[model samples]
Target: MKQRAITGLFFIIVMIGSNLLGSYVFSVFYLLLSLFCLLEFYKLVKQGGMQPERFTGALAGVTLFFFFAANCYFPAYKYIILLPILLSFIPIGELYKKSEAPFTNIGFTYLGLLMAVVPFMFFHAMAFTRGDGVFNFHVPLGFLIMLWSNDTGAYLVGSKFGRNKLFERHSPKKSWEGFIGGILICAFAAYILSNFYTEYNRFDWIIMSLIISNFGTMGDLVESMFKRSLNVKDSGGILPGHGGLLDRFDGLLMAAPIVYAYLYLISN
Candidate 1:
């Protein structure tokens, strides 16, 4: 328990610190994070007997992130068009590997990018969502706060009063009671943030909370389904009690893109 607490504290510090530092720190921090997480995903896929192009996939994912970062920073640069061209090499390179499941390899490689990289790119872009290329930490920080609130609420509420299974097939431990509790708590966090970030009204925060709670839970279930399919226990043991980067950021994987879209639509 102590180890878990320490690790969790350090994790939050690093995450929040990078965000508070500035755009450069945030970009570099998440870029490396996305890369490592992508590598971890490929490792798990390989463990499942599929040969994903780890090197090419990681490189593609990192390059895709850089494209997004550069676009966010420069906005006037036309360099983003190179991403698709780079991604096309994944399959072309796979032709030489002589793997029996060449298509499977290519598919999982792209899946890794989708699952591990793209969502984070959206998240990092949230810092510059205003179209001014100026970075603000409020949205990203609020997003994290709400996510943490949901997790904490779900765990406490579910552990104590959970009766009905939320998804017994994939995650038997999850409960509908816990799910509701999470949303309520997450909504409360958003409400609090609304007071400080008066730029967006309370309604926007509430809506984002709902998105994060529901989709974040879905992400957790999806990861659980994935690990179950592989007959694995945890994604990885990098964190003392938290499993891995994928396990920690699984919620962000599904929630960030949707929230970014919401923010973008409303901002424009």
Candidate 2:
């Protein structure tokens, strides 16, 4: 319990530091983290008996994210059009490799890109999403704040009053009691955040909070399903008590893109 709390606090500090530092730090931090997560996904896929071209796959995912970052930060950079060319390495590299399921490998490689890399890229999208095309820390910061609040509330509430299983198959610890508690707490946090980060106003913040809370639970379950298939307890040992980067960001994977789309549609 102590280890989990310490690790969770350090995680929050790093995220806060990245957001407070500015766009460059935030971009570099998330990009590198995305690459590490891509590598971990490939490792798990390999453990499932399909051989992924790890180097090419990871490189492709990283390059795709970098391409997106450059495009968002500097619009003219979009003309570079190098992402497609870079992604070609996946299948071309597979030509020399020996795998019984070449297409399966390619599919999972792209799945890693879609599931993990793309979501992180969407997080970047949130920063520069305003019509003015300037970075805003509050938007992304609000997301992290809400997500953490949901997790904390769920753990505390579920541990105390949980009686019904949320999804006993994929995650035995989860409960409907926990999920409802998390959503309510997140909505309350959204109200507080509205007082400070008022660009979205109080109503919008609560709506976004509800979206994140519900989908974030789904994302956690999705990752749990992945690990259950692989018969592993944790994604990786990178974070001492928190598991791996993948484990940590599972909720973000499910929440960020949907929230980004919602934010875009409403704002624009």
Candidate 3:
């Protein structure tokens, strides 16, 4: 218990440091993290008897990361067009494969790539937006805080007050009590942080909090589904007492994209 607590504190410190460094450096870090996660995801899929082209999938993942990053740095060209073009190849590549589970492998790999990279890219883009230089740190930092709040709240509340299962089949340990606790804590954090954002209205912060809370839970469930399907406990053993990069950022993966879309819709 002591070891886990200390490890968790260290993880939080590193994440805070990364966010303080702003978007460009953080994007580079995220790209590398996504690459590692893609490898782990592919390895798990392969272990499950699926024959995905690991190298091809990895290359595609890297290419997709750059496409999104390009869009971030060069938003004027609307380089976002590259995303669909790269994504379209998933099915096309499956057609050339002689493997029995080509479609499933292709679909899973593509979905995993989107799940891993798109949100990180969106967060980066949000950070680099014009006239929002200082606010850049807040965008990613907000996400990290909300996600960590959900995770910590859920575990602490669920352990003490849990009764009704949230998802009995997929995640037996998750409970309604924990879910509500996480959402409430996240919403409160969002409320407190709203004072820091002079540009956004109260409604925006409230809505953002709601989105993060719900989608963050969905992200956790998504990863849980993957692990359940593969009959594995954790994604990887890279982070001490924290599982892996994927495990740490699962909630952020889902939350970031939703937050980006929210900002994009409101700003445009």
Candidate 4:
């Protein structure tokens, strides 16, 4: 418990600090995060008795992230062409290796990009969604706060009041009571965030919280399902108590894209 608390506090500090530092720091920080998570995902895929193109896939994921980051920061330059060219190496490299399940390997390689890289891309894009080409940290910071609130709220509330299971098949510990707790707490966090970050109205923040809580739970369940399928408990041991990058950001994995869409729609 001590270790978990320390690690959680450190995670919060680093995340909040990166957002407060400005766009370059935020982009560079999350780009490295995206790489780490992608590699960790490929590691898990390898543990499942299949060989994915780890290096090539990692390169592709990095390229994909850079492609987006470049667009966000330097829209005048065309880094778009580099992504496809780098991605082409995946299948080409597979042909030389001659693995028994080449297509399966290819599928998982791409799956890592979709599951790990794309979500971060959406998240990174959110930092620069304003029409004036300015990078505001309000959306991202509010997201982290609400997300952490939901996770913390669910854990505290569900541990005591939770009775009925939410999804016993994938995650037995999760409960509907916890789910409601998460929603309420997330909404409250959003309400609090609105007072500080007035870029979005209070109602919009509430809506964003709803999107985060519901889809964030789904994200947790999805990661649980994924780990169960692999017969593994945690994604990795990088964090002392948080399991892995995937475990820590599972909520963001699913929630980021949806929240991004919501912010985009309302902003436009």
Q: Pick the candidate with the highest lDDT.
A: 1
**Residues 148-180, model 1: lDDT tens digits:** 999999999999999999999999999999999
Off by more than 4 A, model 4: none
Error of 4 at 15 (Å): 0.8
**Where in model 1 is the C-alpha error above 4 Å?**
none
- Give the better candidate number (1 or 2) by TM-score: 1
- Candidate 2 — which pairs collide? none
Give lDDT tens digits, candidate 3, residues 1-268.
7877888889888878877876666777777877888888887777778876666667778877777665565543466566577667767777888888777887777766776666666766666554333336776677677777777788899999999999888889999999999888877887877888656777787788788878888888988998889888888888778787778778867778878888888877
Candidate 2 residue-wise lDDT, 149-205, digit = tens:
999899989999999999999999999999999999999999999999978889999
Cα-based lDDT at residue 207, candidate 4: 97
Full ranking by lDDT: 1, 4, 2, 3
- Evaluated against the true structure, the overall lDDT of model 4 is 0.91
Which candidate would rank higher by TM-score, 3 or 4?
4
Task: State the weakest 10-residue window (summed lDDT) of model 1.
Answer: 75-84
- The alpha-carbon deviation from the true structure for residue 125 of candidate 4, after best TM-score superposition, in angstroms, is 1.5
lDDT of each: 0.92, 0.88, 0.77, 0.91
Candidate 2 residue runs with Cα over 4 Å from true position? none
- Model 1, C-alpha of 109: deviation from truth (Å): 0.4
Q: What's the residue-level lDDT of 98 in candidate 1? A: 77
TM per prediction: 0.98, 0.96, 0.87, 0.97
- Candidate 4: tens digits of C-alpha lDDT, residues 1-268: 9999999889899999999998899999999999999999999999998899999998899888887887776673565877788888988988898688999999999999998999998888788777567899999988999999999889988999999999999999999999999999999999999999999899999999999999999999999999999999999999998899999999987999999998888788
